[model samples]
Target: MAQLRQWATTLGFSQIGVADVDLSSAEPGLMAWLARGFHGEMRYMASHGLKRARPAELVPGTVRVITARMDYLPASVAAEGWQAVEWARLQRPDAAAVSMYARGRDYHKVLRARLQKLADQLAALIGPLGYRVFTDSAPVLEVELASRSGVGWRGKHTLLLSREAGSTFFLGEIYVDVPLPLTEPVTAHCGACRSCMDMCPTQAIVGERQVDARRCISYLTIEHDGPIPAELRPLMGNRIYGCDDCQLACPWNKFAQRARVPDFDVRPALNDPTLLQLWRWDEATFLRLTEGSPIRRIGHARWQRNIAVAMGNALAAWRDRVLTADEASLRAQMVQALQAWLAAPTVTGEAQAQVAEHVHWALAQQHAPQ
Candidate 1:
């Protein structure tokens, strides 16, 4: 087990642990979350159903699950006071605040390839082994496995939280038939801390360790297709992709570690782009810029829809600010960009129409009553 840990560390994985395949204890919570329609438009989560909890059923002969954690905070985020920087970015109404995770190359690709390599190394060491690797895949209870395997305890926000890495890491799993020593689960440290729940802009974290994906900005912005709910759009603020508000509010995140791999570094295009700046990206530009990034999965139309919602929120947030000449000019430029998109002839397809509607709604917020 120690040798495997050393191998994982060398591969840029922050931690690795083993979990038994039986997850019957977690089934009830999964069912309850689904029954409440909290899964939102992510139908795959529902379709996977109990298979997520029964790893052996999903993958025959999978007696043990090997969970891995990879820290993904960009090397640039300072060891201390980085959350403050993120909070300040969120306050800037015109700046597009993408989730810290999506600013780099797609983690799904990074983790999958690395997990496969780790599997190969294991096979080399202990003769042939049967294993299947997964990263953010729907049919796996990733967080459940991670928590049970002592990678981290599940926090109030329902994300895996680590004392060493906070909640700022990506999780991957390797379902293997090998009988490995199970790692003991850790004690949770989120005692009496409601900061994550209180700080949610949309109150998506409804209860202790319970999140309603229907109201989650990350889900609404990234997973849901078609029009974003009118009520939630205004609350989304400048977040154009996934949200990091809950993680930022967590007290333990001061211990968040930086990525050892360069693959997770922030790209220039994703780093602190203004809404107006991102609003100007055509489909070709969007594709080119997000080529290896997970943001591209939502496609250009959803990207536009997300940015339009943020633009509207920016307009509302800026309405009360005493603007300098440059700030006023910036607001006008954003308004012009919104109007131009609204008037475009090609913004007529069903997907593009949703984006156009959002663009029109953004234009309307400029004069909406305070």
Candidate 2:
């Protein structure tokens, strides 16, 4: 087991633990969460049923589960100003915000391949073994398994949290028939801290250890299809990808570890792009840049929809600048898009009202005395 841990750590996993097959204790909570309809459009969460909690039932012959966590904070992140940098991105209404995790190579591919390599190495040493590796796959309750295996405790934000590593890590698991020694569970230290709940912009974290997926920015921006809700669009601010306000507000994140791999580094295109700059990217540019990225999965239509919301927020923020622009071309372009959206029959009444209000505000700014 020590050898296995050493090998796993060398492959970028920060920690590993073994858990028994029984997860009956978590079934009720899972059923209740599903019953409440908090899973949103993720129907698979309900379809899997109790099979998610029972590792042996999901994968026959599985007697033990080995869980691993890999810290994902990029190495280039400034030591002292990281949190401030993240906060500033939200304030800049013109900048396009891609979630920190998706700025690099897709994690699904990265973690799964590394896990399979670890399994193969173990097989070579201990004889042929029956095992399967999973990373963020729908069939298992990842956070529950991680917590039970002593990888971390479930934080108030409902994400697996570790005192040493915080919640800024990706989890992976290997289900096996071998009886590996179980690791001791760690005591949770969240205590009276409710920063994650208080800082959620959309009030998604309704209670301690509970999140309403319908109101979560991450869920709205990523998992949701079709038009974004009008009331929530402005609240989304400049975030075009996923929201990290809950995790960022957690005090324990001061100890979050940085990734050792270069694959997690921020791409140049995602770092400091303006809202209009991203809005101008047609489908071709979008496909070309997001080639191997997880962002590509959202497709061009949703990508444009997110950017349009950000652009609307930017127009609201810089209304005065738009009015004073001597360049007729720039003014015409902005007005043209606003008018086009207003004319579109599919646009909701609420969206038309917002566009009209913004146009009126801009026109008023233009006629004001110098």
Model 1 Cα lDDT, one tens digit per residue, 127-220: 9989999998759999999999999999999999999989999999999998999999999998999999999999999999999998999999
User: lDDT of model 1 at residue 256?
Assistant: 95
Query: Can you tell me which runs of candidate 2 are displaced by over 4 Å?
Result: 319-370
Q: Which ten residues in a row have the lowest lDDT in candidate 1?
A: 340-349
Cα-based RMSD of the predictions, in order?
A: 1.2, 4.8
Expressed as tens digits, the lDDT of each residue in 221-253 for candidate 2 is 889875677778768877889988888898888
lDDT of 2 at 92: 71
Task: Write down the TM-score for model 1.
Answer: 0.98
Candidate 2 clash pair list: 94-275
lDDT of 1: 0.91
- Local distance difference test, each candidate: 0.91, 0.80
Worst 10 residues of 2 by lDDT: 360-369
Clashing pairs in 1: none
